[model samples]
Target: MANFSTNEFKAGLKIMLDGEPCNILENEYVKPGKGQAFNRVKIRKLISGKVLEKTFKSGDTFEGADVLDTTLAYLYNDGEFWHFMNNETFEQIAADAKAVGENVKWLVENDDCTITLWNGNPISVTPPNFVELEITETDPGLKGDTAGTGGKPATLTTGAVVRVPLFVQIGEVIKVDTRTGDYVSRVQK
Candidate 1:
């Protein structure tokens, strides 16, 4: 396995620590007035979603994680696990709730998703940044209430609730930013 020196530490860099995979969330180089420079890093355990702060000396090193991210299409879920398929190979994998995490709310049928595999098994799944989903449920829009920024909670077809403008009605497709869980815009279709 290859090793990464402190100089290589940066956000989104995956490495192995304590025999587990962790992604570097943040890394800052701090040089003291009289001592060696060290890297202050914030890391998140990939499997557990645990965030940890650690410091490593300038010469410190860690092995690169055996993690692979692949784009897959979302299949249906069976309550216990979510299924995804690699279109290139037609291979499929089922990710449990832990791996899917909060991304479940953004999943739409046949949408492309990024799934990380560790040791040939799924460890994480990420939906697209933007998704257009039809509103399945929401309160009726007011006749002439388009003045303020006030909005109502709309439940999307994927079951994700987002605050949308009062003009948005049920069955209308709207764009949503999955990264922030915010409503982007209304889609004509």
Candidate 2:
């Protein structure tokens, strides 16, 4: 356990409050020009996914949670457990699908991801910000539609659909923005 002042709050920094794990989502140092400096923090509960706003004086200290992050390679799912192996140690840990949530969509075999460990147990998995996937299905691009002003829906090999430009064609590889699930641009083959 460690102590952090309110001014040190940052996103993804886990802190304990009322015997529960909470992470700082966003923190802003505010001073009303007449009052003492304070930190306005938007915190999210790790287990319940609840978000709350709290204020603390700049000099206040809080108990920070002991969280460990390790790079893990994603392995295949065994119907119940999603397995991952630490790249450095080759140690395996299996987490349930519910624990992985929508992040499972971005999991490609052998892909490396950061696993957040709380009390030596996997609590969350964060995938890469971007991934390249081949377009499996999409209508043929309109002939002579070089305007590139509109987009059409296309399905990727992962079964995730995204809007690609009208120039995109089936069997073409494209870069996908995992954060927004939107097509960035078609990859040059």
Best by TM-score: 1
State every prediction's TM-score relative to the real structure: 0.90, 0.80
User: Worst 10-residue stretch by lDDT in candidate 1?
Assistant: 141-150
Q: Which tens-of-lDDT digit does each residue in 1-189 have in candidate 1?
A: 699998898788899998889999999889989988988999999998899999989879999998988999999999899999988899999999989999999998899999999988999999999999999999998857773677999999878999999988999999999999999998996
lDDT against true structure, model 2: 0.83
| Residue-pair clash count for candidate 1 | 0
Task: Summing lDDT over every window of 10 consecutive residues in candidate 2, give the lowest-scoring window.
Answer: 142-151
After TM-score superposition, what is the CA distance of residue 165 in candidate 1 from its true location, in Å? 0.8
Off by over 4 Å in 1: none
Model 2: per-residue Cα lDDT over 1-189, one tens digit each: 889888688898899987767889999989989989988999987656689999888889999987777888888889898899987888999987656877777777788887877788877788777887888999998766763577889988878888887878999998888888878877888
Collision count of model 2 = 0
True-vs-predicted CA distance for residue 100, candidate 1, Å: 0.4
**List of clashing residue pairs for candidate 2:** none
